[model samples]
Target: MSELLQLIKQAAMEQVESSKPVAVMIGKVVSAAPLEIQLDQKLRLTEEFLVLTKAVVDYSINMTVDHTTESHTHSHSYQDDSTSRTTQPHTHNHAYVGTKSFTIHNKLKVDDHVILLRVQGGQEYIVLDVVGGGIL
Candidate 1:
């Protein structure tokens, strides 16, 4: 009886260990909207990486700004003791960086990753219905 009980416990442990991991991403459906997509708005996505043995998403973001200014002066004198001067104006420029994310149409959970699958008419993306789990 003790051996049978031990075997049952081991089977239960194995079943628990075999369970796959799941990730969920939540967002509204923006593709079917009347208005156009905004500048800083995220795109659409699918349902692939959410369910996996282990989900790993590698991403990075970086931003930088640069500026420069130059000036010069011109002077003229000696026409009946009169003098005239001129100066150049400075130069300035600005740069901007924007990052975009992804969304889905189907059931998007809270902790899932938003991944783009396919573009369906215009810029909208169809969701990926993943039945199985993830590997890498």
Candidate 2:
């Protein structure tokens, strides 16, 4: 009976160890290309082991814009000669219209501290965002 009880306790302990209890952890980026993170002094996770969120990945957004602007200008001039004197005043108004395209880039760099969420079964970690050194 004692032997059976010991076996049941051992099984429960094995199950608990296999299923990691810690769901969230902090990590520091050690590499950018072929990304890698250091979870602890002895545990380093490679790129394949991580799933990156937009906040931690390098990405770009393309945008197009069309708008118009109005402006006004005024000028005054005075001239005098031996026989004549005159003054001229001028005013002008104009509008500027155009269309443009641009891109916004977002990226992450090395040495950034990030938040990580461990996927169920503990096989992968989702990089939520960079918490330190700012997201690039």
Highest lDDT scorer: 2
Residue 14 lDDT in candidate 2: 74
Which whole-number lDDT from 0 to 100 does residue 12 have in model 2? 94
The digit string of per-residue lDDT tens for model 1 on 25-105 reads 333323322212112246433333122121222234344434433443444343443655444544444443354343323
Model 2 worst lDDT run, 10 consecutive residues: 96-105
lDDT string for model 2 (61-121, tens) is 5555444444445555455564454445455555544544443344556788889998866
Off by over 4 Å in 2: 1-14, 17-22, 68-104, 132-136
Q: Which stretches in model 1 have alpha-carbon errors above 4 Å?
A: 1-106, 120-122, 130-136
In candidate 2, position 26 carries an lDDT of 89
